[model samples]
Target: MDASRQIAARIEFLRRQLVDREPGPLRDAYLAVPTRERPVLQGTTTPALTQIWQQRPSGLITPATAETQPIDLIDVYLTFEEIFGFAAGPAYPVKQLQALPLGFVLQFCAELLNALSRPGASHSDVDRAFATQWLKEPIRTRVLNELRDPRRALVVPQALMLLARAAVEHSPDSLPDGAKPGNLIGALLAFSDMIGPSGEGGPTVLGEQPGDLGREVIANQYFNNNASVPHTFARYVRRWRELPQQFAGKDGLVDLPAVYEQCTGVTLDDLTVVAGALWAAACNGNVLTPTAELETLLPAGQVAKVLALISADLETLRQAVQSERARRHTEWTFDAFQQRPVIRLGAFLLVMDQRHLIDRAFGWLPILDVRFPPDTHPRPTNHEKLAGQAIRTLRRFSELYVSEVLHSITGQGTTTRRVYDDPELKAAFQGEGQKIADAAVDYGDTWVVVEVTTSQLQRDAATAVPGNAQVKDIDKLLEEVRQIDATIQALRRDESRLTGVSSQIRRRYLPLLLLTEGFPVNPVSMTVIRERAHKRGLLQGQDVMPLEVIDVEELEWIEALQEQQGVSLLAVVQRKQASSLERTSMRSFLADTITTPLSHPQRFEGKVSKALGPLEAVLLKRKQREP
Candidate 1:
């Protein structure tokens, strides 16, 4: 048989073996198999296998249904190694195997089996084949090359165009009617905070037992960067509040709890209390029964409602896992915790229905819940059109945020949306209307020209696919870079026309592109930008400074650094521009250059609190009114 058919047959055979067996016996059988005899199973753990087996429903794992159960790649590898008796080579890490999709894992195993069947295939030959597939060089390189293709058109649609499309697609009646998106978002953020470790009564401490110490260490590593979540929440809240309320209800008087009730059929307070209880239970143990303390905190009805919203049954989870695995066949990225079907789809709780094997209870995986608004809502009718609108909204907010930060640092002299009024400059951009820089900051002799973009790297760009999506995302970013270069060129062409800056001092210009989302600022992208700039004659002049691309995270860090130490953004930019290494990202550059420690958490939380103060107050008032 061919490789594909061989894999399918192998999986079928394995499924039959596992179908009639109980989870505990199956787990014991698997663990009893000596790893010395089957070296490929070296990294497989008892806990991981037990977790996988527990996902199988009681009395439901018939021969017909066994194939439908979610298959962990590690389990497959172990099964194949035990059966085939392939020569033991280097063992793949459990984490690495776990990250791969079902399809990829099946193919990998099939390839291994095929190699072992070959006449003269030695250990080195099998290792070479393994390395090739594991690294994914062949596919990844093809995708990257396709992204650099020059023939691809780089046309980006305007905000108005997208808005018009959305309007055409959905009538006013079809738009979101129940809750204001802003209020709903605010309530969700508060709910997220309530369940977090740093919620209500400070950080929760895992016990001092031997096993607990490891758990505590893992939790600390993950949660140490506490500022990220709050900052993200604050940014989203600000963006949603500032954006035009195209989807919100007309009255706009919906409170936080009302919004939660409208969407979830439960009050935000009840949801928060229940979510906290579940979070606590999850932290304490992998599986927990409904306890007296949890019941005391929330009534049965409320608990059931909250569980319905956030938890899924084994079958539902299996389907979701299958769907996700299929979706990720093209998109190679993986975060085991974040990308788990239940977690990714806004369901953090897992309910095990097999009372015969284990008590009918909830199973908690150590995964952080980081679901966004869209994850909770129904999939939009037109995702592409709505995404465009979202991108435009983010771009506007990013520009505003960057301008405000600049104003704070350089004083009110920082000019935003400055029009090119010079006769020649106006004529140059006549066909495209008046050209304008997003913002310009004046620092005596130094002038900073800013361009803010919210262009994010698309999944296709990250995946091993030579598709249109990859090309389009790359083209959109390059187009933004081109615009930045053009603005810098225009400003330098006529220094006399520069507005809101002192004309007396000889000025040096710094070109900056501020991205709302992180972009790969590696050698390839930088080289591409430089090549494009050279073609446009933007880099020919000695006085011109190379453009710097920094994300909002770096901008926040810089702002904090400025407040703590007397470090200026201009100084950082100058140092980076002068550096011989062209591949390093702004974050790396900051880490290498800065000696003083940054008080990022303090400054970030302060800023978020200030930004979210009014909304938070309103939420608190609503909670206080609750009986």
Candidate 2:
């Protein structure tokens, strides 16, 4: 058999033996082998290993437990899901593979790793080993080539920004009536309400219900709670709500209340209440109930409307599954489920018969649609046009957002000024036909030059077989970096002209590049940028600080740490620079360097509340108007 077929055969054997059977015996058998004898359990400090062996079989993999693995085992499963299982046929039953206990999965993987270490093992011995060994080389190559490379992270942010802007720009006059952008947001909020921690003594959907093991598996595996949905919605409402009014002039304002009423057959206020009510009911162990249960909470018509907005029939889901399979075949890096048909139809709601409930369910993958919006229109051309417009809006928004974050970090006493607003600084660069940096902040003794870019990874670069696509994308980024380096060079050269300071003045200049999305700042990308910058003599002087690249998320995280915990931004940056030459993401760097008192969700929600307060007041008034 060929490598692919061989890999699939091994996976099928393991699935039959490990997944389709009761895991208790296997667990006991594996544990019975003394800890010293079980090489898989050796040298791992993860507490989960001990807990899993001691505790009763839970049959569910919690998010915390899943993270303890040495490698991203989820990705390993997804690789097979996309490449072999879905692409080939239902014979693979890839979704069922995820339902295997985390302990078993880890143990199996560990044993495979241990077996691979043994010298001169027979082909039959290797074949009898777990499937991970057969696909190890491909998995390893893919992980190194694509998975670990953070360039793919750029796609989701860009797609989300575009989708969001399209939603804001979507007009009521459009053909083929569909869910309004606000309705989509409402559905997302409802979905978030469903999955978020239940009220004390309230009905719980995730851990308490029968067949909830499957639900928890779906939630933990797919919708890992890196971001809070309500906070994300708040940010969206606060930011995009202003776009229509600002960009479209006096007549540009979208009446969101009217939009929601028209599309969802209920006012925004009613939708919110009904959505909450529905969440409570769904969580009350009614996963198998008909529409009647939902109707009891709201008007029949309204219930149908909400259901139509959020849920998809089995046929729709089947089609989406197929489309997703096709999408993976085409664009290997395109993993954002929001853009896929399945998530676009609705993420939280999946209509399956009682016989095909969570136990026999086809992995009810629930994507966080709030962070990643579905397509705004049916037509591809219209979607493209809106995406193009969103790019421009994103550019402007990124600059303002970065500026605001910097100003907040610098605080009230700091001198922060936009370079474009300063005539001298603008003119100084205009002579060389160059654009000035976005903003400048006088934080402590250092002069910080801020540059913001919404430049994203092109779709072609993310395709399955990117020929010249990757090269072209890298070239664009290098050019952007070079331009920023040139701008810094000019700023230093014309220091006396613009700031009335001598070139010999021992002034420290820190250049900060704020990306709207995350980019790979791995050794390769960083080395390339550094080498080019060094060749341009941008890093020659001791006065010039190394150019630090931080995405918007990291910037927000830093700002939160500074504001909430009194952490110093300058100190963080200096420490980061001093610590490593081969840079990782700023977020990862922050995680390693500082531990904040507030969790990410708390910090993010606090940040969003500042912007969402006014909007909430309006929403409150609308709610009060409800009888």
Candidate 3:
């Protein structure tokens, strides 16, 4: 396709990829990235992280425990599970690591060092022939976690020499057995596959020679900078803003960030972010005719903006890029490059942003309709629909589990109206474009308002959040409440979904329940949930109206039991009979134990404003339009 048509196609692709946001300051606000802090467990490094190398279970490829996993697996655990002291993830370049097997790590390290220490020619990362090569597979592979080159720079060779010198001085035994001055040379050759039949590259090899930094080489000291905070992300944000021109000027595609850094002195944590952002911004969107606002900021004004960008906080740059993306929005791209989405510059930026986003994209990005005033641009993930499914399951199963417990206790019959499913109720609550409660339960006369919610925890804690994530504190835990709060307001107006339930109960209590992936085990977390829920208005009558979130695991276990027994709650009640545990009412289980209501003083509130009140007027308009 021609350039104009190509740009149009790209804009369309972006529209499908990114949710729309308000324009101007509001859009800027929504585009900001949130800060994240990762938690780590003690006793994880050393032989523990490299247990796979130290004791590969001849037949077992996976590590025995998370602690004994490879550095790659362990790093993911550190972020996804917060099992290690790692505060955030993508762990930023893996330039340096303490827990990886020395052999595997050394292979890459040696390649990086040799590329750097070469004497004659200045090996630049820019010109592939001179620095490095640029390929689509590299971008795609890196984003998907297949490319493992850490510290994309060739500074390793310089650093390696320093390490070798230290090893020789401190303790000779620490060097590889019978090692010589050329040990680094040998390592470089072996790891780079220089000795192969074709004298070309090959796969990485792992063994004892590359295992430890020699026993004397302190693991922690070898990579003191491993745990240091990464700042390349800020530079990547700056790079993202300058992409359209740079990418277009540099041919159909741009070289990787290491090449950029080698030539321009800028650093890139994840090249994919550079590519992803480029796509989200210029190539993926219709920027052929700059927005009127962008036109005004060009040439004369653009220079100042660029200058301001240099010192601009990470959040500011992020908001600017996001705002630009929205301004350039048009339609989805119908064009393809080898069946892959193409933007001369877009592909590169999209790749970079995808690699970066799971760690630093805009915070708590709810899918299209579930948006609120306080946040925008929820991090894109493969888990959105799954999160919804999980919540639905928990709501249904939790209702059944609690209802069964109640029946065994009071001997009073309980009924559940899958009310939202009833045709009459659907008409009442969802006329044309409306939403309703996920599920409902009626325990004798006391009807409970159960609101089931599940938000995807950070798919990539390090780069998933958006904006200048440096300043924006995007707490996954905080996001849980933010999501709950967004859906909670519906409850105040959602009673209509239950019009099918012919209940003449004089008294009704709202037992608001929220559910998300994973169990809340931390007392502090429980406190935050309680406090945040109350602050958002779930804080009404503490005793009578129990407001608690569900522990997905607990309900999941109960869900499994029902499947195994191949019977409904009634049959299980009949078989087990009424024991003391059975006597424990579902109300007590939900209101008293399972949930942490608002009255409890565990107020862990973050500085976030309430979301816009439920779009009542919008819903009303839709209802009016319906027959």
Clashes of each: 0, 0, 66
Off by over 4 Å in 2: 1-234, 242-312, 324-336, 340-391, 412-428, 459-471, 496-504, 528-543, 564-567, 596-627
Clashes of 2: 0
lDDT of 2 by residue, 286-315 (tens): 323345544544567765654444444434
lDDT per residue as tens, model 3, 148-213: 332122222323323322222222223344543333322322222211122122223322111111
TM-score ranking of the models: 2, 1, 3
Tell me the TM-score of model 1.
Answer: 0.47
In order of appearance, the predictions have TM-scores of: 0.47, 0.49, 0.26
lDDT (0-100) at residue 67 of candidate 2? 22
Worst 10 residues of 3 by lDDT: 604-613
- Score candidate 1 by lDDT: 0.42
Give lDDT per model, in order: 0.42, 0.42, 0.29
What's model 2's lDDT at 152?
Answer: 18
